[model samples]
Target: MSTTALSKPWTITRLGWLFQPISDRGHEEAMVLSVYRDHGVIPKDSRTDNFNRTPENLSNYQLVQPGDLVVNRMKAWQGSLGISEHQGIVSPDYEVLRPTAPEYDRRFLHSLLRSRALIDQYALRSTGIRPSQWRLYWDEMKTIEISLPAAKQQRAIADYLDRETARIDTLIEEQQRLIEMLRERRQAVIDESFSTLGDPSVQLRRYIKFLTSGSRGWGDYYADQGERFLRIGNLPRANLEIRGDIQFVDLPADVTEGSRTMLQEGDLLFSITAYLGSVAVIKGDWVGAYVSQHVALCRLERDRVDPRFIGWFMLTTTGQDQLNEGAAGGTKMQLALDDIRGLRVPTASIEQQRRIAAHLDRQTAKIDALVAETERFIEYARERRVALITAAVTGQIDLREMA
Candidate 1:
């Protein structure tokens, strides 16, 4: 709570005094609603990304009406509660609350209750031995005291936030669209770079020297200061670069796979497991590193076919299509060493291959930089939105006109 009083008068009261919990259950016929930390409450069927499967029987679901506060007990501290605008049914584990008096504005409560400060309060009040088990049930939630201005001033604050956030959201949407466009353009650049060379009929097996997938027994060679151990995550999806966090493992002299899978400079790496076709070329300091079983080590005939040129081609659409078609599939899809060897590539001079690789390297670097920058901008916009809401709800801003 702020020590300084605002220009408008405010009243401090417990949440229980303002809102009452209603336990009306078994609304299986109603539409399902879900509470998201970022999106608040929305129809469950509207999003495809949520991994949690809804139960076939909705017998225990609770009925919810418009303007009622729906709290996902397990995630309330994470700002996953919201004043619902749709009539639906939420899980019985959630708390359904409605204003006891008309003095409260749903819009005002939406912003205030979900603000960072209030979420911190919710976290402090939540009970659990583990974070995953943390829950904010109604008994503890009702005791939290908050200061509220008159209903009119509350409306003014809510209106201000709604207007400001919409503008920020617009900019964020534009930035996201730009990022998608840039990615498509990046892929097009790769496809176009390889398009000039005639049909890829040359069997990749003709130029390859030795091929083997990494062996298991990963935990046996665990160490902090030793050779780099590259996992499936190290393979980049966009280009032929080995990226992401590195894990170093000390290799035992007796370990047979360590010598067998030791990566060499100019060596081409392919994802032989579930990831399928992501490829990277080892360079400089990464030469002595070993790979996990999921990655395939392909020591190419560098004289006949440039390693980087082949690596870049593996990222192109045509390359990805061949790998997907040839990979063995059932529950899990994966590529065999022979499948990689069987891949076809455009037969070209080593000089032309180097030129193609160079062109893609430059083009992709520019696109990746732009995508990173745009993502940062979106992040900043989200931070600003949260800050604005917190300021409004905490009475840090004066809304004397609405008083």
Candidate 2:
């Protein structure tokens, strides 16, 4: 048979028709299900098992049956649509669909709709000012065109994807475990090096010229391109490097007070709230960046203390223990400026500190390289998985030939 024999263009509505919107008006005693963005439908009870509080009235909920297609309308553009495997009632905000013809493979359609290409189609059809608020209504979703294959071909493709993706997922999991081990090893090295210093301890206040947080009300100065604005979210958990999701703001002449929070190369930063004790060092790239109020800037006495060594010390168990003991507040832990000032830090001679920092910098670079390579491999594996699913469901690749 020709490779393209099974390919046929079909609109989404033609493949599986929408289920008549049914409400539990008369049936108030139904199980409530919630549709997760990427994950499939899950009963609300399961999510709130600890609270054990079911809604007093589920009469407004919509009923869903096995094999029905469920889409969280608000998040449909994010690949939130999936075939329901459970018989329950979902929120009225969700859309439900059922296959119109017996020949349609539900699993194949699920894979097709969740593919990256189709998800982008969903984004195109969605309407909203921002991505977070985008909504894919039924009118747009119904008109989406998809390539269909014969029922047997569809089933075969789904089965092939299921088997292949499982193997890829296993490998990804193994790589994730290896990355975790590498992190632990890096941490152990940092802890050992710091513990063996056998040097005098000094209050952090003595070594630092200034310890202060950023001023508020700078939101008005936020700009797409300007000086980088660092926040608690930008701080890495273990590494001394600052990275990811950095925002920027124009350095307006009137906002001169922000200069105090502006970072210098080799300066140390500590997260004061939420993820307390998370530390990072200001690199050359972030030299002029300003930090948020949630972050504490420590301008070190470079002549006496090495910033890198201080940053690494915070990641060690001893340093964390001291920070943890002084940490205040429940649920949302915070480190007060005074508490941070009082915390004792180990101090070796400047030369020894520089040597230790240099050694760690080299060791961590090696570990970071390995972790980055494994992360790239995982990304490729995920991309391959998505491509395989898209090709199979769209009949871009013939399963019979692969078989």
Candidate 3:
């Protein structure tokens, strides 16, 4: 085992002094950089080229250069600070700092400040009840203290973190790709199962007892606690699973207009707008839940069609293709209630439908288990990455000997 080096507490001002504010009063044409959390400075134009509507005046923006540290004061607590590698102009609200002493490594400072401990320190220094309103001013920021390692160790630590984090990130990317492939395989399975639909075709309305969308004006009934209010976000794309980002709304006596849209067990919910093909079968837990106007409720006749079978079929590519064909509007896609009612569905005997649904349910459960495992592994990798950076930059682990 190697012994760790001694560390000393250094004030922010001692490490690197704040930059002298330089306004773009000359109106020089320069790229605009947006400082983002986790991600460093990025050109605003690269994200969106439509800056034609931007204000013609650029005199209030601050000029930044390579190796300069930039911080979004309002979001500093959220780790929106980075060392810029571009010569550009940032919003006037951002603070720019330059290293006055050569002894301090900018990369080391960047890593250390972004660590969880320093982020917590920033939160403490910030003055606001809400995170969105929190701001870290220059006066308090300059006086903040951070542990400093030897100059040589600073570079070694930063280098070690840069290399290690990249390796972990690559692992995460591979895992994400595996998940995508698994999802594609799941889709393939559903498609194969539906390919043999040789039964008689009938319009969806012939089998569905009810087909209608929820009424509008439910936004005024939003509450912190009540019946679950399902929205487009709660419905996963091309799947029968419901997401956990559920909202609650109080169904007041006066708001009886949307009562018809209240979900029942085994009810099929379909997104009518934006995300057109998202479908989910409402379970017992969501029995009282009501969907937004953007979603449509389809109550199938139990004697004619199995809800799970229909749900599985809708998740297939063929089903999504039919939905796309029926979808209307250009930018904001939507499916009319009449179009949904007119959709052609291949019908089979109830017994065969049950068997198909059972097989698909088993297969999807296995795939979902694998996906959950991969996601958990990715989470662990991310946690390890953060821990490694924290340990290296804070001198908890000595990288000088390793280097």
Candidate 4:
């Protein structure tokens, strides 16, 4: 197959001739199915990460038979459609299409419709105010033009992709497992080091110059472009520094000084609600970020104790237990300002603390670099898999040569 051109004569036809929209009801007793961008169509119960839960009332769900095409119109542009292998029911919001022509292979339809080329088409034809809101209904999808080979060639192409993609997927899974192992090792190193790193310890209150909790009802100050607004999600889970997407807020100058939530360098931030035990040490770029009420801003006596050391200590098994000891208020996990002030931390000599932190810095960096490189490899492997599928289904590859 040539990357730039097809190998054989292909019929360019509208998808309207290939599929007919179907919405058979009264299959509420059947298994529930969902479409995922990466995994395609599978039983909803099989995935633990699905955000949409099954509603108690299944009377409105649409029936899906084997070989039926299911498309999540909201995410069609992201390739969230697949040919179902099970007789199940899906959300009424989803579109189910049954093949009307015998010339097309079921597996080919699954691969072709989910290809990167077709995803771009879905995105182009969708209607919405913004990209996030774009929706591609069947009315628009049916009108899209597609190229297909004869039924025999379609089956051959599908067979080739099935084998190739499986190999690539297996390799990616191996790398993913390795990344998980490295993370476990990283945590182990931190815990073991903290054990003998310090002998003399003191209450965290002793080193605290000032402690304050973030304010509530600052939603009005949120903006697309302004100073960073730190939320609980931004607090690092295993590491000492803040990470992930940052939210910006245009704070009013009049109330900035009184808020006391504007963080400074060397400040320690703790997640006081929801996901407790998460902590972060503020650095240069995060200096002016305003913390949300869900997080507590602890302006410690930085000169007395290294904020990074304290931050790293909080992530250890011993530190996590202490942090969660006072996580109480209601059904939801929570922590009050008092809970943080009275907490105990491993306070070693400044030189000893820096040594421990430096040792961890070197160890974790090596592991982190390997993880990042492996992750990039998997990403590129996925892109190649998609390109192969796109090539096969679009008749760019000579099926006879593959055989």
- lDDT per prediction? 0.87, 0.79, 0.80, 0.85
| Predicted structure with the largest TM-score when compared to the true one | 1
Model 4: worst 10 consecutive residues (lDDT sum): 1-10
lDDT of 1: 0.87
lDDT of 3: 0.80
Query: Which scores higher on lDDT, 1 or 4?
Result: 1
- How far out, in Å, is residue 18 in model 4? 1.5
Q: Model 4 misses residue 14 by how many Å?
A: 1.9
Runs in model 1 lying further than 4 Å from the true structure? 1-5
Error of 3 at 260 (Å): 2.1
> Cα deviation in Å at residue 235, candidate 4?
2.2
Q: What order do candidates take by lDDT, descending?
A: 1, 4, 3, 2
lDDT over C-alpha atoms for residue 206 of model 4 = 91
Task: Evaluate model 1: give its TM-score.
Answer: 0.93
Question: Tens digits of per-residue lDDT for model 4 on 45-135?
Answer: 9988878879999999999988888999889988999988888999998999988885578888889989989999999988999978989
- Scored by Cα lDDT, where does model 2 land? 0.79
User: Per-residue alpha-carbon lDDT of model 3 for 99-157, expressed as tens digits?
Assistant: 55546677787788788888888889898889899998777777677667667767777
